[model samples]
Target: MTEALRLPAEKIHAAELEALKADDKERRPPGWALSPRAAVTYLMGGKAANGMPISAKYVGDKRLIETAVATLATDRALLLLGVPGTAKSWVSEHLAAAVSGDSTMVIQCTAGTDENQVRYGWNYAQLLAHGPSRQALVPTPLFRAMEAGKLCRLEELTRMGSDVQDTLITVLSEKMMPIPELNESVYAVRGFNVIATANNRDKGVNELSSALKRRFNVVVLPLPDDMEQEIAIVTKRVGEMAQSLDLPAPKNVSEEVARVVAIFRELRGGATMDGKITLKTPSGTLSTAEAIAVMIGGLSQAAFFNGGKLSAEGLAPNMIGAIVKDPVQDKVVLEEYLETVLKKRPDYADYYHMLSDLT
Candidate 1:
């Protein structure tokens, strides 16, 4: 059977969601698929009351997940604020899936995004024929979400123009979207709420106005707290991605994964793990998400080119590519790190040489 290249969070976790629903005994907000507590359990990973195993989606703070889930249960919209690769979009997708049983109601906000995409547009063909009737109205994702009382996701909310971003003010604050052309409005149903994601570190972002900011309950998803946590996250995500891509698991990848995570942590922190050697940080985020991508890329290289064996050679180029986002300054930062940090560590000799040669 053919499969989707990517599945939305709801379809991917359908069984676990069903399991949660079966075992959930707590109060459920209207239009929610699972209770808030059960939804948190789904995200944080725990066995259901029926003993069905539920996988952990987000591997960070349980309280943060709880706060995000709780925000959706109320009238206030949720804004997941974080640096890039901090899993803002990841959490948003899963939260929408867990609460609404449908994570596809999404508006991917971009610089070119306009009011029509956020609100409603006219079906021109129908409009010309029917002349401003409801049949001529083209409902956007946000419109559909309001009509259905499900969560609508706005990704990279800050990337849109300020005027386009302001269009959400009414939909969020009043839970109503007006249609001046039709002389009618779309009043949101009980569970209708918005979940927006924005990266604080991104450039050219249209900062949220104070009025728009007040409509959302901001929950910041932070980076992994430590090396072990970051490593665990990367390992888990890489394993899952490999399975999805039909790639054979590279044997003894834990060590390589650890090394990659360590390098990212050091450069990201601008210091060595032990804090003995100060280093210049790179331009890239070196985020856990990027680490997962590097691991998966390395595994693919091993699977296709190196007789199903992972090595420093396979991981080096991708690791360097991830680190050296800005060719000049980032390369300098990485070279200093390799010379000062990895060169001295005995276990990292292979990585040091491989990365040095590539750089």
Candidate 2:
């Protein structure tokens, strides 16, 4: 296969999956790659029975992962709900990879998505030549997953229109998709399930119907519980992404990463770390993911423009962009934060001046 700009979890962790499967002595659920116990271990990271080190993909509560895995072991589908940058989609991809050994079967839901894209579409020329036959049918990722007993991912589920979102009602509840045109129905094989993600902060999201919501085992993924956790996530992801994109590895940025995470945590919490003062939160989520982006941006700026030295002045532009979503409201929020919070800290006086100059 050609080199991809990014690899799915399955591709990146194929060896770990193999090791887990090899040592999986427990009874496997119908078509799972690893047993529930081993799958959890694969996610949480540990040495398999064969002594292969499985790296941790997620950095959160172990019980939440157990609940998510246990949900897939049953008949119900899994719904990962969270605000942006909470790793809902990341966890979903890894779960599918660990459970089914294939994470490529994905349908990215969007506002423009239609029923045909979710279910199936017809090949124009082939349809004209052969009419409604299987040969001319273009099976979607969901249809193929159902036929193959694999996991199918639906990303940004709430971004799609209500009518298009409801197309899965029958598929989730009945585990079958009817094809009246071909006079045949596609029944989901055992182990076939859907994993979907939706950002809670999305505006005007098409809310899932009560009936549709009932079909899923909902798992709400919260943001990193503390600063250290968020910092670790950002550092690991930034290193991996920089390597993948062939960007220069930043030097001595751990303190910067901690500072970035601290800023986001404070803004998100709407108070200083001591909780003595309140802050007006910005329109932006200020998620850990965005912090990583800011870090990477600073690294790039340093690498090409500043003689490979990462500095607070170099990060100011990216930090400003990440924090300021609304020109008027968010700017005021950030300005107040700079004056009330950053300006008061002796250690952050340089960052305050740098950011103030840019704004």
Candidate 3:
């Protein structure tokens, strides 16, 4: 059988979950796959009781993950708020996988999403034939999750219309979905809850209602604390992504990864690493996630076009594409950054020249 292009978190990290489960001795909340402490270990990475190493899924603060897990153990839902590419969705997937043993229960909220998508819908044929009987009901991810006592994820929650988004208020507040037509309701079983993510930097997002906000325990996922931390994240993610893509490892991968991360960090912070130079921040997020994409794109470029040799020439175009979201304004930002900062560094001479030639 052909391999799947991408596996859910539970399948991708099945071994770690199994190892954690084998060693978990803590008291488990009803319907949870792993205990609260064990779930945290699976996320933050640690050695199990039998000494099996569990790889860290999220590289940020342990406290945040702990808080998220603790919230799920209660009646409140978890809302992971962060700027674009802060791993909001990534963390949500892993958390749901660890807590519920399945990450497929997800609703990708968008501007077009409606009540039918969130709460439930009807099988038209069955409804027409059977006159709104139980068999005519079409369960959505949220509805199914409630029925099975599993965690359901809502991605990009703010993208949905305020009215459609409000549909969640009742389900979240009462832990039940009412079907007035059938005079029935679906009450949440133990261990059922929601994990939602929203991009704080996005424009035109519908703000969450105060009533809806009260139903969740919001946790903000912040960007990497420093250059070293950001570089590590980019490097690790790039390596994993490259392997998945079946691309050959490029030469001096670490050096190239560091260069990409430094450029993003400088542009994002609006200053040089040494604090000696002030710079203009671009309209784009220039997030760590984009840095990972840049490196992966560079690796693919080297593997296919440059005979598996990573160079500033291979990385420059991808870097420009990531940083220059707004064609006219961001171009000026990049040019100034190249000349003022990258040009001054003797080590970045190749990057400055390549980027200048491309832009």
Q: Of the pair 1 and 2, which is ahead by TM-score? A: 1
**How would you encode candidate 1's per-residue C-alpha lDDT over 245-321 as one tens digit per residue?**
99989668888899899989999999998889899999989989999989999999999999999989999999999
Q: Per-residue CA lDDT of candidate 2, range 283-317, in tens?
A: 98888779999999988898889988888878889
How far off is residue 253 in model 3, in Å? 0.8
On lDDT, the stronger of 1 and 2 is 1
What TM-score does each of the candidates earn? Answer: 0.99, 0.97, 0.98
| All candidates: CA RMSD (Å) | 0.9, 1.4, 0.9
Better-scoring candidate (lDDT), 2 or 3: 3
Candidate 3 residue lDDT tens string, 1-359 = 99999999999999889988996889999999999999999999998888889888888899999999999999999999999999999999999999999999999999999999999899999988879988998999999999999999999999999999889998998999999999989999998999999988988899999989999999999999888888888888888888999998865999988888888888999989888999999999989999888888888899999988999988999988998899999999999998888988899999999999988
Off by over 4 Å in 3: none
Off by over 4 Å in 2: none
Q: lDDT per prediction?
A: 0.92, 0.90, 0.92
* lDDT, model 1: 0.92
The local distance difference test score of model 3 is 0.92
